[model samples]
Target: MEQKQPDVVDIFAVEERPGAVVFALAVCLGALVLLAQMDEQTKWLKGAALLVQPRFWPGLCLAGFAFFALCHFISTWTRHRKSRQYSFLPPDELANWARPTEYALYFMAYVFLVPQLGYLPTTLLALPALVFRLGYRSPSKLMASMLVGLCTVVVFKTLLQVRIPGGRWYEFLPDGLRNLLILYF
Candidate 1:
């Protein structure tokens, strides 16, 4: 009896993820470059109180992301080279996929709606939609998930006093709504 070797296809399948990795690296690099330029514009302020200088933390974070992304890109490239297979997608998968597109659209919608709809409504809607899409079938589970999400938002926004994205819809709601929300939660 002979042991079967792992298929070349299986090893190279990992390479397909490099495209996503490269895209992330490019985005991080772009953010770092932007932060560096902004830092240069505020060079005069650096001479002020060292603790008060606004750019220090953000610039450091951006630099850190860039460094990490660079390492990831290099490691992924080496893996791709060793695997010796260049495939953009899985062998049987279609190029024009709608699932990813749908998720992106949902994310954008959530961002845009957050400021107007308030935290609770937007999250309540998005949570159930995501849960259902992820193949969760039980109504009880969906309700429980939504409740947890709503509570998290309430804790962050109300108890923690964290700034939540407020939208036009929030503005139209009566003062009673705010009072009601605060009292109920």
Candidate 2:
């Protein structure tokens, strides 16, 4: 007679990805730093109930955040300790994280231009230009982007009656057409 053992697998284990450890460490450190600054950032008023104090909830939340982040960092570190080494700051992952910042700056530029160039003209120019910048070389795609931008302006301004100011350049146009465009284009 022979006895056999069944194979067992750890269901809770996760595959580590590149840069995960660094991200976890960063989050944990950030939480700890914020938690340390809680006293300076918030006040504890005398005679105020603990529940209603301005600092109470924030302190509690930051404490919990720090605790959980520390736990995650410990777990990640332990999991990866025996595995193959990875770069502390992988360039590809850092670049991926920063990529959204470019789009955010673009949005800020668009916001600034809306006041200078009017809503319709800005939308018309921005949409196609953004499409082109995103590498849509086809004429049909560019036209579609312009159409979408135009429809959005019409819907928000004309149909919904949103309050957006006329562009600086609008005053240069003939008075009647300028007024018309300013009011509902």
User: 97 in model 2: Cα distance from truth in Å?
Assistant: 1.4
Q: Note the residue pairs that clash in candidate 1.
A: 115-166, 115-167, 116-167, 116-168
Q: Pick the candidate with the highest lDDT.
A: 2
For model 2, the local distance difference test gives 0.90
Model 2 clashes, total count: 0
lDDT of 2 by residue, 72-130 (tens): 99888887786756666778988889999988998999999998999999999999999
Candidate 2 residue 24 Cα shift, in angstroms, is 1.3
Q: Which 10 residues in a row give candidate 1 its minimum summed lDDT?
A: 88-97
Provide TM-scores for the models.
Answer: 0.49, 0.82
lDDT of 1: 0.69
Per-candidate Cα lDDT values, in order, are 0.69, 0.90
Model 1 lDDT per residue over 1-185, tens place: 99878788876564345255445456667866776687465554735876677766776777787788777767766776667555434333334444488889888998887776667777888889888988999999899889987898878876886766555565566898865554333
TM-score of 1: 0.49
lDDT of 2 at 57: 91
